[model samples]
Each structure stands twice: as structure tokens, then as C-alpha cells.
Target chain A: MSRAYNFCAGPATLPEPVLQQAREEMLDWRGTGMSVMEMSHRGDEFVEIAETAEKDLRKLAGISDDYAVLFMQGGASSQFATIPLNLLGDKTSADYVNTGIWSKKAIAEAGRYAQVNVVASSEAEGFTSIPDQESWDASADAAYLHYTPNETIGGLEFDFVPETGSVPLVADMSSTLLSRPLDVSRFGLIYAGAQKNIGPSGLVVVIIHRDLLGKARKITPTMMNYQVFADNDSMFNTPATYSWYLAGLVFKWLKGQGGVEVMGEINRRKASKLYGFIDQNDFYANPISPRFRSWMNVPFTLADDALNNAFLEGANERGLLNLKGHRSVGGMRASIYNAMPEAGVDALIDYMTVFAKERG
Target chain B: MSRAYNFCAGPATLPEPVLQQAREEMLDWRGTGMSVMEMSHRGDEFVEIAETAEKDLRKLAGISDDYAVLFMQGGASSQFATIPLNLLGDKTSADYVNTGIWSKKAIAEAGRYAQVNVVASSEAEGFTSIPDQESWDASADAAYLHYTPNETIGGLEFDFVPETGSVPLVADMSSTLLSRPLDVSRFGLIYAGAQKNIGPSGLVVVIIHRDLLGKARKITPTMMNYQVFADNDSMFNTPATYSWYLAGLVFKWLKGQGGVEVMGEINRRKASKLYGFIDQNDFYANPISPRFRSWMNVPFTLADDALNNAFLEGANERGLLNLKGHRSVGGMRASIYNAMPEAGVDALIDYMTVFAKERG
Candidate 1:
């Protein structure tokens, strides 16, 4: 098999050119005679790599100097705790809009530290649709408003950023970041796990408004404290250097492909092609509300439950790999991230067409 | 330059064969048609990779079933807080031995969660020697006794593991683990950042006795809880997948070199050759107590500090790299971990001899 379409949600597929460049430099990064993994975090070479990555990301995301972008470890799940630890200054509560599984996880973890106010929830609707912002029962004393911009498991996404006004807005953008242009100023903080659209597992990129710093609770582990990371340029300890370097390569590739604006256009087309097919076919159906459907993850179900395995098996046979849905959510999900070329989606749609005709 | 000897403490040099194998598999791992970086953490391929690495490490380190080996992130610095959070169940204070920078750091971080009792310290002695275990003021009510087996910056090492009777003994073996064979039964938990003798920088290998799990404080982040990781098989969150895979490759390479016993012999010889040259040469001197000299990191100084830059430049021209000492302790240091070949150490000795002859 020659680089089958990997749609594993995350640890998702990376660009082929990025992988090729990484391979070429694995033994000797340029003429350094050492792999980037072997470079010191404090050394000039790695510092340059780390800086270039942050700069490229800022340029791509349109992040301003008012925000400090941190290259951190332990993924977005770690940030679920980190955000509340660093943001809940003297407030007794924080508002959360529960859209799906990822949102609930954040709410549960934040509950350990502060009073969690569920302003709105789509769980009552089986997480297939986003609750209208007008229906929110927000807290006046809340420190921040938190929401999941894209839920990877349930294929649900928020169509609008909540208007938090004075309260800071925080978003878990793990599956959607770098897939399109984003308004960095709309949120007080935006964190995304690198595996999906960024680079690899274990690295999370955090863009935080500088004013949010210096508010960490006393019990917060220094490693999880945003200010400590901000002060050290995210090199307070030995960071995941290799992963950081790879992310820089990804940013370079994204630039070469004309930035996130271009990626946004391509991704919307890919998602539309697959979702369009799902709606037109009687044998397949997607449960997400059309308005709240994710452009990165498309979850669909077969008309007959028994044919699901056959659908997946046949898809794999055609080199469309990892089309299996998340274990928590039953049917099938196709995650078309930034690296998923339009060709991969075309192949998947072709396979789906053949399978539906044979099994319908 | 073609793969010069990297002597910075860590993210240190990895075995050439391990890097080569990783390079070959960077794009498509073992016919999976996806890089290991792109694999789902819960997928069969990555699960197999994760399990095999743990098994091989257990075999090499002689870890038993009573110990749950965890592949963790955030390096050893995170563990400085994690150890106290998990181990100080009902106890107020934990015993600590501060021999060098790393031990002091552990003590400082542990201070946040527990009443840290400095049982013994070599700080007054300039961290040149380890205080005898008999001199330690062991606390009867202490939760655990912690020590650094090797300090990368200070170039100090403990020749003997301290006896704390029934108190669980924890060792930060970040710079020394797997450089030699060890008695796993002597430790309650042994954690090492993987940049040194292991494969990469982002991953940390932890060998913790099962009895030590489930004691985390109420305020502990779920990501920091050892039991959560143990129960979830370290997939409680997405781990550093690529680093874990690279570590597995290094473990396989170590096995081919006849395991830790062979590595131990080679490491000893490498340390001896370098130290012997420094001692014999008048223009160079190593300040460590003879018995306490690190087998992994050798920090030395020139008789005239003025000649330091010239010495490093000459060595770099000969394809020897990263030999500069830590800024906190200015001089020259060569880190010879398990991956640093005996020939590299020999090359360093030859360069040191010539530098002495030229500048004496």
C-alpha cells in the first residue's frame, strides 16, 4: 500500500512532503550531523526551529503580539485542566457550552476546580445539533465561557463563537485549528492538540491573550501553569523538540499551499463532497444538523447495521484507510483534516458509491 | 559533517542504527502505509508498538510484574510534582537527598505538595561528592525517600542506592537509566526522561511498583495521576506516539547489543578512558570526587579558562559537537550516554591530549 488515506481522527495523516523532508533530515538535519531530536532545547539550532514554528503559526493564524503562542505537551486533554487552573482567577464559576463528548470532558475536569455552569447543552438532543446561543443560561459571575469548536467524536461543531462580552472565551479547537482561518481575537484562549491538523500527538499549541497570565491557582503544577510557559518561551523544561520541529515543517507546507485560507477552501470542498453524497444516497445518512456539521470530521451511518463492517472492509480494500468511526460513537466517521488531499475524499466517495450500489 | 559525536547531556545522542531504522519507517511503517506519527494510539499497530517497547524495557531493566511500566510525557520535571502528589498519601513530609542541581530541583517541586525533609545534602561541599547514606537524617514518618542517581549538569553520581528500610525509594534516573544493569527491586519508582540513554526527548519511561498507585491528592490533575495512567495503559490521553515508537526501536537496538550488561561494561570503559585522560593531563582537570564521577556526563575545566573557546572550536572542526558545559557551570562537558560510542570517547581523549600539548 502506498500511503493510503489515513483518517484516524488524530494522530491523523500529515502532508507527504513534510514526511519526506523529515525523513531526509532524520540522521543529519541539514549539516548539523545530528537529528533534531538530539539537539539541545537551549541550543541555537533548536531555538531557531522553535521560534520559526511559532512565527509561522502566528502568521498563518493571524495571531497578534497581544497573544503569546505556547508550544506545550500532554495534548489538549492536559489543557482541559490547564485552562481552568490558569483562568479561574478569583471567580467561583465558569460557563461551559456542552456540545459533545469533548465539551463534557472539559466540564468534568473543570468541575474539580470551580463551580461549572452549563449555559447550554446539546446532549438533550443527542449531540447532533448545537444549542442556540440565545438559549444559554449564562452566569454573570463566571470567569470565562468555554466551548468545543469542533467535537471529533460526534462530528458536531459550533457555528458561531459565543459572545462572552466581558467574560473571556476559551475554545478547545483540537480538530478544527489550521483547517481554516480563525478569529484569534474572539477567544481569550484557543488550544488544539497537534495530532489532528497540526503535527503529532503529545504536542498542543496554545494561543492565549497575555492578560490571562498570572492568574493560576496556587495548587497548579508549574508545568501546567500558562505564565511559566509564557515566561520561558515554552522551553522552561526540555520540550518535545522533534515534534516542535515537525510542526514547523507543517507550517512551512501550509504556507506553500497558500495558508489556512486556501486550506479552508479545499477542506470545505472535501467535506461538502462527502456530505453531499451521504445526503443524496438512501443507503447512507449523517445525523449532524447541517448548520453544525464539522468541516473536518464527517460521521455517517449505513441504512442497515449489519452492512457496516462490509462497508468499512470494502473501503479499506480500495486504499481508503481508517474510515472507522470513533469507538464511543457507533457507525463510521471520515475525518478529512488539513492534510487529507481532495483526492483522498474523491477516492472515498467513489468507494462509497460502489459499496452503496452493491449493498443497498 | 557526517553524524558527529553529540555530547550535550540530553536530548543526547541516540544509536545510529536506531535513527536509520526510524528514517526508513518515517513515511510508511512496516507496510501500514502510514507513519507511526499518524497511527491512532488505540489502534492495533500502535498498541503493539507501545506494548513491545514496555516489554523490552522491562526485560532489559529486570522490572517485574509488580511494577507497572508507564510511557509518560512532560519529562522528569513533571514527575518531581507527580511523585509527591501520588506517594504522599497520608504523610506530610518526604525525605530527600540533595546531591546536585537535579536533586535540589526535585526537592523544590516536591515542596509544593509535601513537607520536604532534606535528609542529607552535598551542597555545602560544592556538590562534588555524595554524602554517605549513614549521614542522612532519615525521617520515620516520611512518605518516601527520593534521590537523583545521576546529575547531568554537576557531573555527580551516587555510587550506592540509599537504604530507607520500608519507606518507598524513588530515583530520578533521567541521565543514567539503562546505561547499565540495575536492581529493579531496590526502587518503588524509577523515572527517566528519554533524552539520554533512551531514544527521544518527549517521552519518559516510568517503572513504578503497583502498590504505589492510587494515592494521588484530591487536587491532582487526572493527567498527573499515576493510577489513571496505569489503569488506562498510559493512553488516558494521547501520548507522544512517534517518540514511543523511536524508543521501541532503541530498545530493540539495545537488545542486539546484548542488553544492559554489555552496555554497562562499555559505558564504564568509556567513562574510564575519558576521566583517565583528564586526570593525567596538566592543562585539564575534572573537579568531581573520584568515586562520585558520572559515567554518563563528564564535566571538566581548562587550566586557563581563556583557552576554552579555542578548544571547543578545534573539537568541532574534528566533527565532535555539543561539548560545551552548562552555562551555570562554565567549562567543557562531554556526555557519554549508552548511545555515545567508545570510539567517540576515544576521539574526545585524543583531542583533549592535543589541546593540552598545544596550550600547555
Candidate 2:
């Protein structure tokens, strides 16, 4: 049987080459005589893998020395709590942009640690648009400005990075970190769960400005302290070693695919074709506004809701899998991250057209 | 090349069959046309895997419905902070028995959240022995009594379960979870890092008595709340999906090896031979007291400290690998987890005898 085009929002699609490499190295990593999963994270062999992964990620994103790329455990959801704990030093409040599902979750978690001042919200309109920055009532007294660049569940994304003048701009890029080239200088810290554009779940990649360290609240757990992790090089405890190694393999694969700039072009093309068909057809429509529709996650609904099940069944039969949207908002979402190939998108488009014609 | 024995603490060793099965299923899991890594956690197939894994684990440990088995991220170290945050509800303090590195860490983390009562400490003895429970000064008003049943780094294992009276007993069983049969009803909560005896790193298994739920502090992060995890069936957020799947496979493998009791006998035999050789020989030594020494982790020192590097080199040459002890307390450690075959232990013993003779 041929491989399916996996459309999971996360634990999503990975490059075939990456999967193949992992398979070949499952028993022995580069003749080290042990599975990479079995090697100690502190061992020289894995250390080299770790260092090289960080180096490659730095090169791919053009990250500077001021940013510490720490490989950590717990997904981006954990970071929602950690960010506020680490950044809400003397300030009693933090500014948040309520864009969609992820931003709302982050805002809710932040409320536990600090006073949340929601500067902007798209909730009034079913989160179909990103509120313009000029209208946002962001706070100067806030410790940091937090937002989600791409909301995976609602399939809404901001086209431009928010400018936060003097305050630190912290963004959760879990859904869109390496789908394209991102400028590291514009943000104080950036974090992403690795399951999407990266390797697998369990490992989170954090890129933070070195100066942001050492301001955690007294009640913060050591594992949640950014300064502690930076001091120990993310080895404050045993990390997700297998996931880290697989991420290294993914970094190498990304580099081999002509880097993120190339990946950006490929991702753009894949998302373009899928979204294009959705927009062009009368039977299919993406709910989110054009400006806020995500390039990574394309969620669309059929003109007739009754055909939803039939559409999904046909899609599954055609090997287009995990196309269901988040249950919070019903429809279908195709998350075509960096790992998704153009052919996968083409296949989806062809299937959509055929299915529409047959049911029209 | 033949597979070498991996003796480093963890991400230590895994069953070869598990690795082989993962490799074979790497690309297309069960004709699903996508690797298990690529499947959405909520998808029917991955959901089945998670359910089966949870059921298998419960059966292997003889865990009753009264306990919730949670598959969490952030290894056992994170639990050092989470346990106190979740369990220390109304009580201002918790009881701790400091045996070695892991216990001290747990105790220290608890202090950040609650007042700590050090009931008994073996630190004065260089962590070479477990203090007798009769000398303990436990607090009746404490939230819970936490201890390290098996200290991986110090090679100490409790010979008897400490009776906590009405107080709950929590343990960091990272290194010793499935190496033998455990009576789940004997403890209130037990958590283990998956890299050892389980499948891989990044996943922590927690078995908590059901009554312990719903009492998290107001300040606790949602992800840190045991009630949140238990209520959500350990899917509060995107879990470590791959590790969860692999852990399910490891559970199946353990069952095939005749469950925990059979593995317990094999483990006892393996530890007996290695400790037997070290105990009978004058050329080597195990520093920890005999009764308290771990049956899973055996730490031994050469007669001459100068030959530590030489012994490791010889062992590596003979495909006996990762035999070096932890740098925190350097010498040699052979971690014979469920995955380490009896032959691997025999090989290590033969290499040790040959090396000692050569250096003698």
C-alpha cells in the first residue's frame, strides 16, 4: 500500500525521507552499536547530534547568538504557563491578543499567573479575522505582549508580526514555526511544539533572547524556569532524547531540501493550490477571512452540510487521511506543513474536484 | 554488527523485538498507509493504540480502577514539581525521606510549594544506605509522604514499603517500574520515566489512587494538574503520541515475556550474577549496603580508581557498551532493565573478570 497524505493538525505529516532515515537507524545510529533511543542524552554521540541540530536550526532560521535555541519537553501548551511565569517579573499584568483557539488558551493560562489585559480579540466574529493593530489597546505597563501567530484549530493566522515597540513580543509559533523563514530579531522569544513542522511530539523548540533569562516567579517550577534551562543547556533533566535525535534528522532533511527559503516556496505552493480550489469553487468555502486564513492549516466547509460525512468518507477511501477539522469548529482542515509535498496537495485538490462533481 | 549491551542509566536499553517491530511499522502502521508518528492522537487508530496501551499497563501492574494511569511528558524530574503542586492541597507541608539524588530533588521541588519535613535522610552517610524507617519523624499533618523507592544514581532500593499511616505515599519509581511486580495498592501514587524499563524518553507513566484527584492548588497550571490529566484521560493536550504508541508496544512485549512476575525472576537472576561476582571478588566493590542496593541498577568500583577509563575501553571493544557510571558519582553502572537480556549480563561479567585479571 502506498503512503497516505496525512492532514493531522499536529503529529502531522513528516517527510518520507525523514521517516526512512529513522527506520534505517532504529537499531543502530551511525554504527554506534545502539539505537539512538537507547543512547544516553549526555553521551558524546548524542551530544554531537544535539549540537548539530541546534547549529542547523540556527542556520535554517538565521538565528543569532543572542537567541538560545533550547530543546525542551512538554508541548507549547506548557509554554503557555511557562511564558507568563518567566516574564511576569515585577509587572502585575500582561497584554494578550485573542486571535483564535490557541491564543484564547494561552490567555486563559496566563490569567492564573498574571492579570490578563486582552488588547485585541477576534472572538466577536467567530475568530474569522485578525483585529487590526491600530485598534488594539495594548498596555505599556504589561510585562510582555503575547500572541499566537497561527491558530491551528480555527485556521486563522496573522500575515504580519505584531510590533510591540519596547515590550517583549512573545509568540507561540507551534503551527507555523519553520513553514517559512522567520526573523528572530523581531521577537523576544519564540516557541513551537515539534510535532508539526519539526519531528515528533514531546520535544518543544524554544528560541529566546538571552537577556530574557532569570526573571521567573518564585513559585515557578525549576523545569518551567527558562533561566535554569539556559544555564543547564536544556539538560536540567533528561530530555526527550529520541524526539531530539529525530528532530536533528529532520533539520538535516530540511537543509538537504535547500533550506527554509525553499521550504517556504514549497509550502506556499501547496497551500495555494488547496486554498485556491476552495475559493474558486462554489460548493467549497473556507470560513476564515482571506487575510487571516492560515497558510499552514486550510480549513474549509462544503456548501451543503449534509455532504460532510460523504466527503470525508470518499477522501479517506482516496487515501487523504485525518482531514477532519477540530471539533470545536466543524469542517475540514488540511495542515500542510513543511513536510507536505506538492503532490499531496494536488492529490487532495483532484479528489475535492471529483467529489464535488459527483455530488453536485 | 551485533547489538551491544547499553548499560548507561537511561534512555538506557530497550527490547530488540520492540525496535524491530517499530522499524517494520515505521512507514505504514498496520496498512494504515501512515506511520504511527503521523497519526492524529484523536484518530481512531491512534486512539485504539492509546487505549490498548493503558489497558495493558493496568493489567501488568495489577492496577485497579481506583488508580488512573497517566502518560505524561517531562520525565520523572518534572513530577518533582507537579506532585507537590497537585497533592499538597490544604496541608502546608509534606514528608520526605531523602535517600539520594532523585529524592533530594523531589524534596527540594516540594519545598517551593509546601513546607517540607525531612523525615529521614541518608545524605549524612554519603547516600550509600537507606535510613531505617523506625528512625523516621514523619508529620501527621503533612500532605503526603514522598520517597524514592529506587534511587537510580545511588543504587539504593527500599527493602520494605514505608507505612505512611493515613498519609498518602508517593514515589518516583523512574528506574524500577516494570523490572518486578509491584503492589499498586501499597502506594498512593507512583510515576516512572519511560526511557528505562519502558519504551523511550519523553513519556512518564503515573499511577495515582483516584481519591487523590481534584485538589490541585489554585495557582497550578492546567497541564500540571493531575485532575486535568485524569479527567481528560491523559489527553488534556497533544500528548507525546509516538512515545505513547511505543510504550503500548513495550507493554505488549512485556506481556509476551510473561508479564511482570516472569520479568521479575529474570531480573533477580541477572542482578544476582552481576552482584554475586562483584561481592565475591576482592578486586572490585559495590559501595552501597547489600540489602538496600538496587536489583535493577548495580554500581561497582574497580580496586584501583585509575583503571576506570581502561575498564570502559575494554568493555566497549568487546561490544559491552555504556558501562561507564554516571559522572556525578563515577565508577561503573550496569543497568539491567527489562530489555537487557540475561546474556548481556553474562557478557558484562565475563568482560569485567577478564579486564580485572589483565589489570591485576
**Index of the highest-lDDT prediction:** 1
Instruction: Give the range of the ten consecutive residues with the poorest summed lDDT in model 2 chain B.
Output: B1-10
| Candidate 2 chain A worst ten-residue window by lDDT | A267-276
Q: What would the per-residue lDDT of candidate 1 be over residues B43-150, giving only the tens digit for each residue?
A: 999999999999999898899999999988999999998999999999899999998888888988999889999999999989999988888899989999999999
True contacts kept of each: 0.76, 0.75
Structure candidate 2, residue pairs in collision? none
Which candidate wins on DockQ? Answer: 1
Per-prediction DockQ comes to 0.85, 0.83
Question: Which candidate comes out best when scored by TM-score?
Answer: 1
Error of 2 at B318 (Å): 0.6
> Per-residue alpha-carbon lDDT of model 1 for A92-143, expressed as tens digits?
8999999888999999999999999999998989999987788899988899
Given candidate 2, what's the lDDT at residue B275?
Answer: 91
Off by over 4 Å in 2: none
Residue A238, candidate 2: alpha-carbon lDDT? 87
| Local distance difference test values of all predictions, in order | 0.92, 0.90
